[model samples]
Structures are given as structure tokens and as C-alpha cells.
Target: MADDTGHTTPTRRELTGRIGVGLVMGLCGVLFVSTARISGGESIRDESGSVAEVLRERGRTISDLTDAAASKRTRIEELTQGTSSSEDRSQLVADAVGLSAVSGPGVRITLSDAPTSALGSIPGVTPDDLVVHQQDMEAFINALWAGGAEAMMLQDQRVINGSAFRCAGNTLLLEGRVYSPPFVITAIGDPDAMIASLDSAPSVKVYREWVEYVGLGERSEPLDEVTLPAFEGSLTVDVARTG
Candidate 1:
């Protein structure tokens, strides 16, 4: 395009079209870079990607497993319907499967980590000092059982013969489920004896000292009635080797 009488100049329409194409190219370049970063995992995740997402996925998996286990148990019950001494067999199977829910006078004990500020205020106390460990939970459960708890529950699930308690950071993982503080353990037994047992274990003693020094939380209450839900996860022996 030519300006009147002399120098050639681009028309306004030509200039605008070139600028628009340039902008589009610039945007495309940016999107390309962004996509490369995402493909490289730099933009999408950190070293430990989405712990919350992993936990939610685990929760969904556990739910599905529980439902499948329940269906299998129902099938087993149907198959065993007319077996010898059916009533006795059923009772034995139910108890063995941790399907029986029990209620009676019990003692409820809760253990919780100290607040961060509380731990910070204490001299020489680390963050670990403020959180309840798996050992602490095991101590209470063992003591309660030794004190004659007919049935016990930890965080609403029945404590079966093979139930395991583990600690993942500050959270409690019990029998394929995760729980956050405060962890509660209820035992249907002589409340006095249960509480006494909890108070007397060596680990429990250490926990109490931390409770005094670091402000960890501990509470025990006797209840006239407390019922624990039946264990819902698979009871199938995952590993079996003939002796």
C-alpha cells in the first residue's frame, strides 16, 4: 500500500491483521510452553502429589472392598444354612468373623495429640512429642484386653483378633481405615479395671508424662452402655501356609 505522493506504507487493515496474527502466535507459544511443563510433571504435581487425592482414592477402594466382603459373607451364610448344628455353627461363624456387636457397661478412653502451640511452648519437645504414636494406641488396647474386655472397639470398628493399628504421620490407620485424633478406644468390661489397666501400662505411663509435660490430651469415662459396630472388612486370611 502507498501513501499519497511518496513513501510506501502498510495499510491500517494490513497492520491490524499482522498484529492479530502475532498475538495469536504469542498465545499459542505460551500454551505450548505450558503444555510442556505439564507433560514434564513440573506444573501438575510436586514430589508427593496430592496426598488428599490419594487418601480419597484409598477410601473409595476400602468401601468397595467392604461391600464385596459383605456380599461374600452373605453367600457363605446361605451355603451353611442346613449344616449340622446350624445354630451353633452360625454363632461360631459370626463371632469368628467379628460380625457380633456387643453392648454393656464400658470405659471410653480418648487420646489426642497436643496442640502445636502447646508443644512449641514446652522446652526440648519436638513435634513428635505432641502426637500419639501407634505404640500408645497398642498399649491401651492391650491393657484393656488384659483387663477383661469382652468386646472392644477402636474408633467405631470392632477390634478383632487380627486388627492392626498403625501411625501415618499424625493419623491412625486401623484395619484398612484411617482416623484422625482424638483416637477413642471403648471396652465393654469392668470400667474400673479397664481404666486402671490403661493407667498402668508402661507405654501408657510415658504417654501420661507427655500429657503432663507437653499438654497431650487424655480422657477416660465410664459408660453404662456402648455398642461397637461389626467389623466390615474382609476376614479372609490373606496369607496361609500349611505348618
Candidate 2:
């Protein structure tokens, strides 16, 4: 179609089709970007949620172990009171040990700072080095169990299954309080066997070196009877389901 200037203009149908195509392309681009952003955000949220879940599970496991230990102790006490026969007593004792091995006839280990000469010979004993660390305490407790401990305790705090032995800046954290030297860890087990096992353990022997050189702590007072406290903690396990 020629206009007055002999130039042709676009037909109405062609202009409408061009406009519709442009609108469709713009909509598709917006949708693509929005989908990408949403997918990335969901990925980050999923990762964070997974990490939180793992930590929760770990906490629950620790709690359950503590509760189980406590329950076992209570059951043993009941059994001991209900029967007087030698067989019954023996069975009760066995049950108690099974719940959480208690040590008997064990030795008490007291930790403190060493003499000036001893401290000077090695790395200067700091507050951190003076007291027992959680790992050391755990090693000692584990060794006692291996050596047939009937029960164990650190001072008045019972070393239960849930018992946490942590050292922060020379301060001992047990159950829920800060303890200072001389930090005493008592175990009830065969005195000879416990002592031998402790003396032979690499961890104990290492600590013993600290004792000889830095006087980290000393072990003594082998008693015929030393009772350990029962476990105290929660018992619920929170599990995740996969489908």
C-alpha cells in the first residue's frame, strides 16, 4: 500500500504479531532468572538445616548414654536391697557392672603443680598444664574400666556415663562446676590391676612424666572400697527419616 509519499507502512496484523513476540520473550527471561534465584536460596537453606540436624543428633546421643547409665545404677541398688543370698548379691553386682562397670579397690590420683626444679626442666607449667584435661581424664577412666573397675569418681562428682570432664584455662569442669587442684580422681577396682594398668597406659605414663618432671599430679591412697555415681542425663534419641 503506497501512501502520499509513495512509502509503504507496516500492516496492522504484522505490528500486532511483533508486539506479542516481544512480550512473550520478556516474560520468559523474567521467569528464568526468578527460578534460578529461588533454586540457589533453597540449596543454602537445605545445607544449613542439615548441619543443625547433625549437631542435634550428637547432643541426643550424649544425653541418652547418660540416662541409660543412671537407670542401670538405680536398678542395681534395688536388686541389692531385695536379696540377701550370696548368689543374689553376686548377680546384683554383675548387673551393676554390666550397666556401667564400677571400680573397686582402686587408687586415687591427685594432680597439682610440681617443684620449681621440675617445672623449670620442662615447658613452664601453665594453668592449662597444671590440671587434668578431658582427654586425660577419659583415658584414665577408660583404662580403669578395662582393668575391671566397679566404680569411679572425681572428688565428690561421680564419673557417670553422661559426666563431662572438661578443662578450660586451668579450671576443671565436671558435671557443672569448676574444680581446682589437687584434682582427685578415684576409682574402685582391683587395686593391683588398676594401678598396673594405669601405670602401663601410655596416657597415664605421659601424665606421670609430668608428675615426675612438673608434678602434674600424684597417685596414692589405694582404698578397699570406692563407689562411683550412676549416670545422669537424658535418654531420648531423635532420629531423622529418609524416604
Q: Pick the candidate with the highest TM-score.
A: 1
Per-residue C-alpha lDDT of model 1 across residues 87-167, encoded as one tens digit per residue: 687788777656876678999999998889975576888888889899888888899988888888888788888887778
Instruction: Give the number of the best model, judged by lDDT.
Output: 1
Clashes of 2: 11
TM per prediction: 0.75, 0.50
Q: What is the lDDT of residue 36 in candidate 1?
A: 81
Give candidate 2 misplaced runs (Cα > 4 Å): 1-104, 115-127, 229-243
- Candidate 2, 118-187: lDDT as tens digits: 4456665654565557677767777777777767777666665545566664556564445665678787
**In model 2, which range of ten residues has the least summed lDDT?**
229-238
Poorly placed runs, candidate 1 (over 4 Å): 1-48, 75-84, 240-243
Assess each prediction's global lDDT (C-alpha) against the native: 0.83, 0.66
Cα deviation in Å at residue 38, candidate 2? 37
Tell me, what's the RMSD of every candidate?
A: 5.5, 11.0
lDDT of 2 at 214: 55
RMSD of 1: 5.5
lDDT (Cα) of model 1: 0.83
